[model samples]
Target: MSEEEFRDFDEELSEGDPEEGEGEVEVVEQELTKELAGECLSLLSRTGNGLSHAYVRLDLKNRKLTDIAAIQSFVHVRYVDVSGNYLEDISPLGELPQLLTLHADNNRLATINLKELQYLQVASFAQNKLTTTEGLSQPMLDRLNLSSNQITELSGLTETQLPCLTSLDLHGNKLTSTIGIHLPSLQKLYLASNTLTKLEGLEGLRQLTTLHVRENQITTLDGFAPSMEGLQYLNLRGNAVEVLSELTKLQCLPFLRGLVLAECPLCELDEYRVEVLILLRGLERLDKDEYTEDERADAEELSKQRAEEEAPENETVEHT
Candidate 1:
């Protein structure tokens, strides 16, 4: 950026904050003025019609802005970055009918009720004070990041609201269960570092490939259904899973290749690795370690022996 892009602080700010304190920084109320807009706007491009010129990217990061009512006039902008600011209200951006991408992390936004942008694809509102997913509705959004927020429940989110969503990051939230999420098209889901005790209502997400629920209170694998056939990577590390039977529920995931269970209470068992491989023979990696040839062969033998032992009991019951 050129030197002209930076604003010159007044004499009072250059010296120090005299009344506030020696090290404290005061937050002055600010707005997105027309002059500031002209200074910040940079990426020039042709419109979708290819007839008119317009600035498509408006980056105003770390401007400490509280309001942005002036952005409504920039109707042609497609990408915006207003992160690291003191903004608590951004309803002014709802006017950008052509916006496709937005990054507004680390803000003071308590509620987000923007008008549905049909072309929006990528959105990140991480590290905010959002309590729910009530107002986040983007029809064409592909990737969304709401990590490190105060979201307790996905009350208003559904597959119908985010039909095209593929990747969702909701880690570091306050979610206790996975009930309200109904996104069937999602492939990647990050729900680590939450207060979830059990996994449920995720059978609808048949297309999910990666599921990260690390560092939670989950003690068993009761919620996994046989319909999750596309799951490849399952991260359940740093949980309280101690029983060996909890992994039987994951045998339905035919495509599962990676499974993490380190730091769990069961990892301390002498035959933890061998037992897991015996139950889920399809796993190629476990706890960040790839299985060796000998390990796979030994587990295969143990699995056949275990299954044969159970076959006699089943046969006796059927004969009766």
Candidate 2:
């Protein structure tokens, strides 16, 4: 609970026993913003021996904390969840070099700098008001979720190479292009619900497996880099791509297994499923349905029929 909520409870207790209530109220008030770290410091204060160097975890979520600068004292804290609060400045956390995972989403934080926390792995700053990823980098960072923010460019990501980074979630942002994203080892990329009209700047992510570009404004499959041959799962569910011929361009993705085009306008075509299965021969699933042997046979037969029809036209052009 917040300090305001505790004040109301303290008032009620004070009404019962004036002398006893005054002491209890003072203690609670002091503990409310104890050491300027909210409930985390309150718990540390009760430890009697002071904050231990061995303490590794601290959870002070939804405590309506305005200040957490006291976190510098807990130098050994590895995991911290300070989500859903009124925090604005988190520069104090830069001193905690042992921090690994930090969940500070859904807060009023305008900026966060964790460049010093080299051991930090998972850093989720989603649903905040961050306009840029200026000072956000770590050597061992594996997963980063900065979705639902105002990030427009990918230059922040291009500035450094996160060698160990794999999963990157940039969904629900205002990105119109992805020109310089250079994470080489990245596997899963979530760019769903953005304003991207073309798929570019992915040549560096040669190890990418899962790509989610659903709910974007992509119109064609021509811009995808050849490095996307390693892609196994692709989601272009709510795009503007209107033709089945687009699947032919993705023939290079031989490892593609699952594809989501449920709400796409191209899914309404008469030969949509069969044409997709034929073009992307390695597809094991399409639009939430598993590709069966019957479907494969039908697609193969259709492919032969189209090939036969095109043969006569080619022969006539050759003669001319």
Candidate 3:
């Protein structure tokens, strides 16, 4: 689909459905069975005037549905999952001002704008035809999953302030760099299976704990900064890491507990496991196996012996 179709809207958030789409109006009024409507209407608050907030929480997942224009009547819907559908236009949902969490994965939607959603917290737009993140500017968002898309850049996200954002999943995109996107409170970041050649933009995230950058073109550890001291779990399984000494940068991360280097070239070293255990002294797990206390002690002893064996050559050079 063309990117021009994803234009930003300036529509004001309001109550009540639009006065058009008589076909959808019939779907909501006639197609709904009496038993299903009664069960769903029970979730609404009945007033002296009429029924209020119909279908506030709707789950129409994998129902083989094609048209969701009927959702315009759910004015007070706070959470909705319309996954696995053939919907191409969710513009009808922009009327629901109280929307919070939305799960719209596995659809054919090429564009959607929820900038008016003030209280939105979590959003998942994965497995779609979206080429950009144009209309996702909610300030209260905490988690976002936009994996398995054709997204090329993170341009639209830099305009908003996401102070409470903790986790971001951008795996299986065409991202080449993460230079402008900055979230101070971000803790977990997943950028696996992308085209990243370096790890430069993550220097400012001091609260980050988990980082998964596997299956990329990263070949060195020089890009990692000291601000990543709080990182505990790291997965760099299938990167271009070739040298064992490159892992020395990990010494700055004191809280690191688990590390994965399965398919990397460094895992083929003669003393791979022992050298890694010695470098990252307090690691409890390496690759897929958990290390025991005795193994750690043995690795420490071997490291000391190796250091001692290389000491006399330095003394002879100093005397000469």
Task: Tell me the number of clashing residue pairs for each predicted model.
Answer: 0, 0, 0
Which has the higher lDDT value, candidate number 1 or candidate number 2?
A: 1
Cα lDDT tens digits for candidate 1, 1-320: 12221112111111111222356567799988988987888789999899989999999998988899999998999999998888888888889989999998888777886889979999988877888988877899999988888889887678778999999989888999998888889988888888999999899998998888888999989888877898988888889999998898998899888888888998988878898998898888888777899998899888889899999999999999
Using TM-score, give the best candidate's number.
1
Lowest summed lDDT window (length 10), candidate 2: 5-14
Off by over 4 Å in 1: 1-26, 307-320
> TM-scores for all candidates?
0.87, 0.82, 0.79
Best by lDDT: 1
Q: Rank the candidates by lDDT, best first.
A: 1, 2, 3
Clashing pairs in 3: none
Residues 1-320, candidate 2: write the lDDT tens digits.
12221111100000111222256322121112434443353222222235443546778777766677667787767788887666666777788887788898776566776555778889887777777766666778899987877788776564264668888888887889877678888888888888999888787788888888888899888766677888878888889988888878787787778888878889899878898887888888787678789999999999899999999999999999
What are the C-alpha RMSDs, in order, of all predicted structures? 9.0, 11.8, 10.4
lDDT of 2 at 80: 85
- Is 1 or 3 the stronger prediction by TM-score? 1
